[model samples]
Target: MLTIPKELPAGFEAYGRSTDFTPDNLPARLQAAHSTKAGTWGLLHVLEGKILYQLEAPFEGEQLAAAGEKIVIESEVPHRVKFVERGRFFVEFYRKAELTPG
Candidate 1:
């Protein structure tokens, strides 16, 4: 596993851990554009080579996630990855914090 940063954006908390994957073993659907259910977010970690993270709706663009780099996936948003070269990476899921009564 790559050394992912411990700091997370405000209001976000990692719901799961120990997620590890690589291009050679990645599922076909994950390699394609797909969105998580509402309120769920994804964090892609690049441990080697380079990969492209693309947005399709609500926003549109492509980002390079190379070694030591990570790409954030907004909730209910369309996105995909195109392998640029031999690479290794993993994804971790996160969710927003629920507000407490004021």
Candidate 2:
């Protein structure tokens, strides 16, 4: 099932830069549905409006992330995010373990 992390896990560090998505231009993978790295995490912060985040099977459900709210994505978890209204958001990738941890 989809879950909400109260805070970031220990040792988790930003792997890449934060990404912004708007109603006008959204990534194809994020739109079509995709998963993150095996040890990669994602934090979606909604700056304005609302977003509809969906998870794949085994944890099939939709989450509403509004302004001032955020969602923590598990590593390798199949999921996708969508814009509920005209707004913007950013996703910060993290690596809780190590960059090359297996």
Model 1 spans with C-alpha error above 4 angstroms:
1-9, 98-102
Q: What TM-score does candidate 2 get on C-alpha atoms?
A: 0.83
Candidate 1 lDDT tens digits, 12-102: 8888643566667777887677888888877888888888887765566778778898887777777778778788888788998888899
Over 4 Å off in model 2, which ranges? 1-4, 97-102
Q: Quantify all predictions' global Cα lDDT against the true fold.
A: 0.75, 0.81
Judged by lDDT against the true structure, how good is candidate 1? 0.75
Ten-residue region with minimum lDDT total, candidate 2: 1-10
Each prediction's TM-score against the native? 0.78, 0.83
> What C-alpha lDDT does candidate 2 achieve relative to the native structure?
0.81
lDDT of 2 by residue, 1-102 (tens): 457555678898987856678988788788767988778888889999999888887777778989999888877778888888889999888886565756
Q: Candidate 1 at 14: error in angstroms?
A: 0.1
